[model samples]
Target chain A: MKISARNQLPGTVRATTMGAVMAEVTVDVDAGAIVAAITRGSAESLELKVGDKVTVLIKATEVMIAK
Target chain B: MKISARNQLPGTVRATTMGAVMAEVTVDVDAGAIVAAITRGSAESLELKVGDKVTVLIKATEVMIAK
Candidate 1:
């Protein structure tokens, strides 16, 4: 499996309550760009640290680069 | 709790083998933009039909929008 993102965004990650099967990774995008967040086991296992810089890649056909 | 994509991407979703915990949603982004794709059970359970328009939202700290 491959994971890639555009650039690096700064955030502080906090461990949240466990999900149905795995724990949740809550990252507070300091700029409030991403006010709230929740990710499953994979991201958590990646050891998302607090005050870490990670990339979030969103891939969809509908993402339009409009000028 | 929420699933959102930038816009609607065109793709033909074919059910692949079941994942470790849930089934995988394999959508062939016909345009070849996404080229290869794999999503977890949630996308499949959403009733992603073949040749449907779905939005894929990827939230991470590293998305950089360069102007």
Candidate 2:
């Protein structure tokens, strides 16, 4: 699917940690591991599991730069 | 400064677009151009301009993933 976010890193799921309302999914990418915090409902809907392939998305607005 | 955010990409400033409250700063990284929307005050404080070296940061909680 097409997304507006500029950063898209393809990776394999490494771990999943679910909280009451949020879930953190760790993905192993070429650079390293990236952790994403998403809604538990979305996680459940996606049925995310270890070894599954996914793409991490980050919006340009949510990005920050340090000099 | 040390930050907990996992994704940190080093790049050079490419452009800057300022609005009333927020400013968009584009950085040219190894991957490509990454845009960041920051408060105009912050942008001014940093004195961001073209050709400046910087590091793009994204928090884990602000990230999402798709299958």
Candidate 3:
């Protein structure tokens, strides 16, 4: 689905850390490594694995700029 | 406050659009323009103005990776 979030980075899954309710996935992008915390359900649904190609998406509201 | 969101990008406030309840902020980072949707309260609190320097913050949970 099309999203409004402006930041989309194509990267490779560097690592995955699963928790009871949440999961952390680290992606290696050209800029740097981006870490994402997604629900365990979403993580499992995606069947994310290390070295998988993916694109990281972030919503505008979820972004904060500190001056 | 310290945050767990790993992506921190230093940029300049390119523009800001405020509404009754929400505001959209555009920051020009090294990579590109990063847009942020924040509460009007937060936008007012920050007093964000054009050309202001800021660091964009994103939480890991707010990030999503699509295969």
Please provide TM-scores computed only on chain A for all of the candidate models, following their numbering.
Answer: 0.40, 0.91, 0.89
What digit string (tens of lDDT, one per residue) describes model 1 on residues B1-64? Answer: 4344333455665544443333445566655534223333344567655566655444333245
A-chain TM-score, model 3: 0.89
Q: Give the best candidate by TM-score.
A: 3
Can you write out model 1's per-residue Cα lDDT over A3-61, one digit (the tens) per residue?
A: 45444455666534344444434456655543223345665667666556655444454
User: What is the CA-based DockQ of model 2?
Assistant: 0.63
Candidate 1 residues lying further than 4 Å off, grouped into runs, are A1-6, A15-26, A31-67, B1-9, B16-24, B28-35, B38-67
True contacts kept of each: 0.00, 0.82, 0.86
Q: How accurate locally is residue B5 in candidate 3, as Cα lDDT from 0 to 100?
A: 62
Name the top lDDT candidate.
2
Every model's DockQ: 0.05, 0.63, 0.68
Higher-lDDT candidate of 2 and 3: 2
The better-scoring model by DockQ among 1 and 2 is 2
lDDT tens string, model 3, A1-67? Answer: 8876688878899999999999999998766678899998898999999999999898787898787
How would the candidate models be sorted by lDDT, starting from the highest? 2, 3, 1
Candidate 3 stretches greater than 4 Å from native: none
Task: Estimate the lDDT of model 1.
Answer: 0.47
Q: Which pairs clash in the backbone of model 2? A: none
Q: Please, what is the whole-model Cα lDDT of each candidate in the order they appear?
A: 0.47, 0.88, 0.87
For candidate 2, give the lDDT of residue B42.
Answer: 92
